[model samples]
Target: MSHSRRSILGAALGLPAAVAVGTVATATPAAAAAVDATAWTNLELETGITPQPGATPQVRTVTILGTTFLQARGAITCNLAADTKIGTLPAAMTPPTWYVRATSPRNNSQGINACRFEVNTAGSVTIYGATSGNPITWVQFDSVQTIWR
Candidate 1:
């Protein structure tokens, strides 16, 4: 009776093993080495902001790697009491409407804000800003990039 019980247990284990072997055999090479769609590469952006307020205005350039994504954020500010204005010229000056705004005196306000840009090509992007009469304080911008190869 004990020998018969052992045989029945062996058969039960063997049945599952056979099924697993069959499943493995049916699996394609592509399925076994399935490519992960969610995989991503490490991306970094070398960022810098210039004309540290009270200094000469200079062009700020950021370099990014090949076929990458770019994002930028910036703020230009001046003391409204001092009669200062902020303007943005993206690529060119000609416009049906040239956009310019007065810097908000509100402490938390991001005066003269600009959004991100998508760059798929390898190059340098220059952002320019200037202050007229009295020197502007803490006028700056920043950018970051991510590259997937």
Candidate 2:
């Protein structure tokens, strides 16, 4: 019968207590190897992204290897359903990856906000989270640092 280490130890030592996992100090060889193998290299470029003129201000850029990431660190505020250019991309989102995604909207009280974002061939980013109400100012837009290769 295959007995757990705990059962064997309990029977031997007569200690009727449950022991939490990771009792041993050193890591197992397989665990160590798995950790070493699954290393990530998500790089951030030193260059900064310049924001266009509007309420939708403050855009940042970070590059990793050949891939480029355009990110908005803070809440990107947009003015009244206007098409505010968020920031420029490294290259145009091609036909295959033409559509970019936006996640985690900061505010969704009144209605669902729309991420009207577009990447042009000349590497221009035009995006805004706008509401449907009159004089609708969208607040707190969250995007996951859209990447371009």
Q: Please tell me which predicted candidate would have the highest TM-score against the true structure.
A: 2
RMSD to the true structure for each prediction, in A, is 21.0, 13.6
**Worst lDDT 10-window in candidate 1:** 93-102
lDDT tens readout by residue for model 1, 1-149: 22233564586577877797887789887763443332222122223333334432222222232222222334333343232223322332122121112121122333544322222223223222323432334444343323222
Error of 2 at 90 (Å): 11
- The TM-score of predicted model 2 comes to 0.38
Candidate 2 residue lDDT tens string, 1-149: 32233554576466433433333344465544332111222222112323223433334445543334445534443354444555544332222144444453434545564455545555455545543453224333345456533
Off by over 4 Å in 1: 1-53, 67-77, 80-85, 88-138, 142-149
The global C-alpha lDDT for each of the candidates, from Candidate 1 onward, is 0.32, 0.42
TM-score attained by model 1: 0.19
